[model samples]
Target chain A: MNREKVILLVEDNPDDEALTLRALAKNRITNEVVVAHDGLEALDYLFGAGEHEGRDTSVLPQVTLLDLKLPKIDGLEVLRRIRADDRTRLLPVVILTSSKEEQDLVAGYSLGVNSYVRKPVDFVEFTEAVRQLGLYWLILNENPGRV
Target chain B: MMDRLFSLRVRVLVLVLLAVVPAMLLMLLSARDRRDASEESGRARALQLARSVEVDYMHRIDTTRSFLAPLAQVFALVPNLSNVTQTACASFFDKLIANTADIFQVGVASTDGTVICRSPAGAESAASVAAEPFFTTAMNSRAFSVGHFEFESVTQKPALHVGYPIIGPAGTVTGVLYAALDLNAISTDLGKTADPSVSFITLITPTGTILARYPNPEQWVGKEVGTPPSLAAMESGGPGITRESVSLDGISVVSATVGLANAGASEPGAGSISALVSVGIPKDQVFAGINDRLRDDLLGLLAAALLAGGLGWFGSGVLLRKLQLYVGTTRRFSEGDLAARAGPPYPRNELGALGRSIDDMAVAVSERQQEIQRLNEGLEQRVADRTAQLEAANKELESFSYSVSHDLRAPLRSIDGFSQALVEDYADVLDDEGKQMLGRVRAGSQRMGQLIDDILQLSRVSRAEVGKEEVDLSVMASGIVDDLRRTEPHREVEFQAAPGLTVTGDRRLLRIALENLIGNAWKFTSHTERPQIEFGAEGGPGKPVYFVRDNGAGFDMAYAGKLFGAFQRLHAMDEFPGTGVGLATVQRVIHRHGGRVWAEGATGQGATFSFTLGGSS
Candidate 1:
């Protein structure tokens, strides 16, 4: 039996978060989905802070969806912190934001965020964008030391 | 003086008087001499009558003496007394009768000097005496004795008596016989000799007795002369003539007196008894002939003078009329009537010359006027052509501006949209480097779109009509700064927006200007630890200016002049993300509202953008 992989969704907009979850579901990759409201909550779940405590880090989510515009810690800072730590230095991060600003994309890529995505304004096109991201990062992609 | 001499009337009058006045004066003087000669001939006839009277009287007296002498000789020879007396008386009476017809009266005295027989028969026996003075004076002289003139009883008239003494046979004492003669008949005959035009002539005896005068013989006969100055002057000298004023027959006369003397008498007293003959020509008759001739001459001169004056006046008027016509035409031409020409049929003189000059002047003036009219029309045509060309050029420029603003932006937008779409749709098919390169392509496309937009906006500002509205610039600047802070929330920026700054301009356009200025501030200050921006107004009234100041990567002031030019960039693309059309757009917006924009900056210190919107209220 093949064990299903979990994907972490870190997005500020509810619409974008739902679109990404629907794309994974439509692709038949029924993995466990953990939703974080922003970059701060995603960090908390990884570090076992206030509301997300005592989480096992060895069974980490396969990929995190980080939105650039978050409430407290921005997506780029979260990505920097994860790349600086040895335990999550190799974690897969995809930057998903509504802005097509170049500075944000460059800063996100330099901080070791694995992929940068601009959220589409059209809902059908946004669903396609999420579908392609899921197929490449989860189905067709390979990560090291996976059980 | 020239105006006076130029008159035609004066010239004509001078010419006429010069030829006519002297001719009339010469005719008057010659007529006066002819009247004087006619008066002198009357005086010469009176002198000839006086000489004839004297010659006839002397011959009668000499014949009487010879007859008496012969009778005395016969009486002495015969010695018969009765016969002798009868014969002597008969012979003497016959001789007296013959002589009395030629003379006035004749008388004979007896030879014994006692009695005389007179030819007039009444006086024959009146006196028979030998003691009478004529008998005594004749008996004592050898020649006949002439007695003094006296009044005679026989004729009752003035007479001269002549006596001859009788001589004996041996030439001893003898009887004297005398003859008596009346002088009035001879003087009466001499008075008839005067000419009728001559005045009365009077003959006077030397003893101042009046003899006879023409036209008044009865009043002057037997009257003694009253010793007139003419008579006194004639008595004082031989052959003397004098002019004297005298009263004759109770009429005043200027008488000329001439003394009558015996013929060939040179001695003072040798039968040279003084007789004064006076002939008078009155002054009225003497000058009457000359005055009639002078009156005719003066009338002729007056008529000639009037004729000359009339001709001069008519000639002058003719010349003046021609001159007045020429002057009137000249005046009309000077008053801009070039068509005015002189009248035809002018005189052949200076007036004709003047008319020709006026016609020439009119021709010249009309030609110049025509040329000027043509030049004015040409100038107006040129101006109209120029105006048409400008209008066409303006229309072409308007369409070009519209195309730049509306059409040029469409392609840039497509490039940016398609590039952004590639990154979003094809992100999985690309590797990391390919994705990164696509990101750079999208970024470059977006930047190019922004640059096109900025350039289009700049063009639009220059082309658009400015609509004015009151804008609170301080608030607008604060709002823009707030917007910049929110655009990139990580940046720490300080804003100092001055309060109470208002200007009248297009609010939307001014907003664009402020946005560009503030955006530049924000972008350039990105490298600073604490970015600061200030917006305020400075300077006084009539020169109030607004400024945007930033602590940023200021450019060198040497290249600052190019800041407001379209697409002029100062910083490298990696340092400042800009199309470099922001300030150019600001400049265009300000200039559209009739204002100016400029920048002041230095390398690495700060930059300030100052502009004027020509504040309207």
Candidate 2:
């Protein structure tokens, strides 16, 4: 196997996380994807603490997909933490949520998340949202100084 | 006194008397004059009868003298012894006596005063010879003479004697021819000349002796003429007449007398005889004619007066009765009974005029009363309608306030909750610029939430139904100040709350009002070393007023007018954090309790807010 690229998925709902991973595998952008469930957990994972300790530091994720509502913390906090850290400051962050609330979108963009996406109520539209987010973060956009 | 003076019946009666009295007086005076005229007429009639008696007596005497003159011619012829015949003298004398039957007797005597050739031969025995006044007077005189009146022997009635001398050829006395003229016969004819209403004729000798009287001849014949002044007056002069009241036979008589003289005598002579003829009207009978007339006149006057008086009284009564009815109706109308009306179907006169006016007045009064009633009803209806409109408006305002509170708070909560979540979770992913921006957003959302709460509180004040309870305004104010201190634990606020400042009002609303006022003081005085707020009672008992006063962020008094308006902030968010709706909500709460709120301040000095919850302490 070629050296596997790592992807971080910051989602709170377990059903949405399973659907997003399935859409990435069908789109043939299957990489070593890690799930954090909340902003606090995502931050801990990136900094390698709690369950993320002893993981290879050199193998940081190429992109992160964020949900706005989460347990223990929220998606916007996770994105803010990611952009504030020096190691993950330049990393691409995508905001995803089932809510169409306007303030959440504006707040996501204001916190320097690369993109914002709303999870649709229909199953097909939700799967398409996951597919587009994975392709843009994993394959389409070239992250600088990345191997 | 007023009742007597103003009585209507007295006025009517007085007016009736005023009109009737004069007419009655005139009738009485005319009746009296009529009676007097009738009495005077009776006296005149009696006097005329007396004059007739005098004329008749004198005429009979004159006729006898002429007869004797012719006999004297015959005696002269016999003395000359020519044409002397006994048959001729006897026949002529008989015819002369028969012709002078009204005379008592007619006879001729020779120059020796012996009676001869007497017709109705008994007359010689009935007549007196030489002792007769007429016979003696004729023998003594050369001319014819009339004797004094006397009662004749045969007739036993009043008689007047007359004598004529029979002279021979050289005018010597040959015979005295005498005749006794019955004065009663003349008086009987004179009585016929006057009405029988107590008229009497009397024949008297010129010596004033009573001779014959037509009425009561036997009784008056022998009496002297001194009783009636008229009898004495008749003997005084020739053809003189006088009127007098006399007592004849113990009965009062009104009489007149006239003197009788020989027909050819212009001067008094022994050969000429004068007699008095008097007529008397008994006093009762003299006035009897007038009495009848006066009685008739009085009766007529009484009837006329009664008729007039009755008519006047009845007319006045009818008029007054109608007038009284009208007056009564008018009185009732004046006392506010506009429906009062006069009696129906009266005469058409001045009283009718009054009735019509009263009826017209009643109609006007009824119309005015109806108009007043209609106006009152309309006013009541208008007031009811306005009250209903005000109630409806109050209900609508309450519902609107509830909607604003509920709907506005929900959205603000969502915005704040999501913004807080965004800052906590997304801080790691944000750059310095990003983080700063997020901090601003979160601050804005929190501020917005506070603004919504303040606005909702203002709305609640405007629309809340005030619940009444006895509230201790000073304790409520102090409690609010303590709560505000806990909200900002580092802020220092001093409270001077008067104890036992009780008020009757909505406790919840009053506490809300005081909380806003004191809370504003707490928030505005965050920069001050010590902030002071006061709560106390103002004014007097029964009208006691509770007021909350604050010394905090004092604003310009020029702008104080806007202090109670919603969202009117005197301080910016950076200078003093507030939604600017606290004082507005306080004003609305105070106003809902029928109180008043005001503020006084300058730009750099502190603000003092004062509010009154008007109620009994």
Candidate 3:
């Protein structure tokens, strides 16, 4: 239980966060989920800065699931900061957002994100998307340092 | 195009020269007449000179014959005279010669060629003179005769010999009375009136032998001249005339020849007695008068050219100045100064009237331009006011459409999600009525959202800029039909699209317009047994009209005018499924392309929707 993979989720909306959590729980992914309310918290958790300061710098998250729209900093900027830092440059990142705007998906991937997944309006489709993401990123995807 | 280098003055000069050159050429033709006139004058002058000198030539023979004729009579009476009688006649001859020095000597010779008597005793040999042609001529004649010219032994000068026969009482010739007249005396007389620079006088025989000549007569007195035709003409007793030839000095000249009149002789042809007088002058001097005439002609031509050129130059300058003013006025008018006009009318003539016409035209143009300017200002103000009003309305419409798209979507999504949640989670507690109510809410919300989207697209079509391209409406109609068939594969439908129906318009907007049209056909044709939809372009009044005709449920003609309204529907929702904004979108698209759309239908007949891509057509 202590050796569980750390997963960072960046989202600002309460309903979207609840829905995503519900979807993840339904997909049977009981990982060490660190929910960041905004892009700033997400960046801090990944790079060990801001409120996540003094945390073990070597204890990196296995995957980051980012949302594009946020209160202060956007999810694309968080991904950009993570990619820019050498310690977190190779870390796996997946963009999850409610926006179907093509520009958001393009921007997220342009910042070195590993995946771009739209959070579907339909909960059933949303659950299925989360299941695939958890299966691929937590189990199938391999990272040499973390493994 | 006229080169700028040839100004008005230069062009006028050229115009003057155009006349001058031909005039000069014509004057040159007349100058030939002048040459001919000078030559005629030369001939006449030469003839006059020859006639004047020829009188002297005739008098020489006449004087000698006058005294000698009576003397011959006296000698004939004493045909057998002694030496005393001959000496007495010689003293009479000397007395006759004392009165006239032109008579050199007089003698009488016998038929035996012996000197019978001398006028001044011992003046000749008293031997037979039969060898002398004069003596032989006298012997042959019964009364009188003349002989050819020869050098007399006594005087050693060239002289003409005249002889008369002394007949005896038996009417037989006994001796000859002879006279030697000086030929140099005739030359001296001709030289009195002769101008050497103009001409020289000559006495020549019929055989072209020169007997005497004036002006250096010592050098050319007895030489044959080169002008034989003159000598021949004179010898033939031709009238006084001139001919071209060379003189004895080998210089080119025209020689005039006249037969000298014999003196007191009954016949001029007797013994071919009369001498021929001729005059010759150089050709250059004869034609020299023409050079003065040509020089005067040159001066006159120059004066004429200057007069015409100066007049033309001044006139052209005046005309060009007026033209320049006209140009300046035109330029100012073109530059948008509507008040500018060419002024100051000219008098009544072609060029003057042209200047007046320019001013009149400029005034008209200025008035028209001022009117146009006023109209343009009014139009521009109207356009500005209309544009601002349009911009305001557009801004309001944009925000309304944006709010419809952005703000309304979230509520719609929430309504749909909540309704779905109610159906799923409260299925046990909710009765059929309750579930139906929630479903109606969800359905109505989704329909409203679809309406919003269609309305937004309509607004977008109005705002968008048109990009024109060659669009095959046939191909596009076929595609929409295929999509419709794919969406409802069980709905058996027959669709006909005219092949190669092409036009230039925005492809995307035209496709949207076509979709709405064909989609309406599809929806409206649902109740028909065999739904047939046909799309085609047909020749219309001013442009090709495209129509979508369907064998489907159609509206009453009374409501046709309201057919393209946003919510206006021809069919009940239970019968035909549509948001009722489809035709509105089609109208918007057609209007965006600056085209028109209309519908024609009856209650039961199929409907036909027609449109023209050509604006106002």
lDDT at B306, model 3: 88
| lDDT tens per residue, model 2, A3-45 | 2767888876665676667657656676888888777888888
Q: Highest DockQ, which number?
A: 3
Interface RMSD of each: 11.4, 13.4, 4.0
lDDT of 3 by residue, B1-617 (tens): 13552376687898889889998998898989877887788788877777877766666667777878887777778737544366676777677777666667777776786775665655755466678766665676465667777667776677787788878889888778888887777778767767866567888766556677877888877776554564455445566778777766777776677876543244555335356787888887887678877889899999988888888888777777777777777788778776767676764567666667766877888778779999999999999999999999988887666555645655655566567667877899999999999888877877776777777777677787788788999999999999999999999999999898888889888999999999988988888999999999888546888999998998899998889998888778888877888888899888877789999988768899999886432
Off by over 4 Å in 1: A1-147, B1-91, B94-102, B110-115, B124-151, B161-182, B206-208, B235-255, B262-266, B269-272, B313-342, B348-617
Superposed Cα deviation of residue A125, candidate 3 (Å): 29
TM-score: which candidate is best? Answer: 2
Off by over 4 Å in 3: A1-147, B1-14, B48-56, B76-80, B85-92, B117-126, B168-174, B193-198, B207-209, B224-227, B233-241, B249-252, B260-274, B281-288, B306-363, B380-617
Best by lDDT: 3
Q: Report lDDT (Cα) of residue B152, candidate 1.
A: 70
Q: TM-score of model 2's chain A, to 2 decimals?
A: 0.88
True interface contacts retained by model 1: 0.00
Residue A99, model 2: Cα distance from true site in angstroms: 25
User: How badly does each model clash, as a count of residue pairs?
Assistant: 8, 22, 7
In the range A15-37, model 1's lDDT, one tens digit per residue, is: 45655676566566677889988
Model 1 error, position B613 (Å): 23
The chain A TM-scores for the candidates, taken one by one, are 0.90, 0.88, 0.92
Worst 10 residues of 1 chain B by lDDT: B78-87
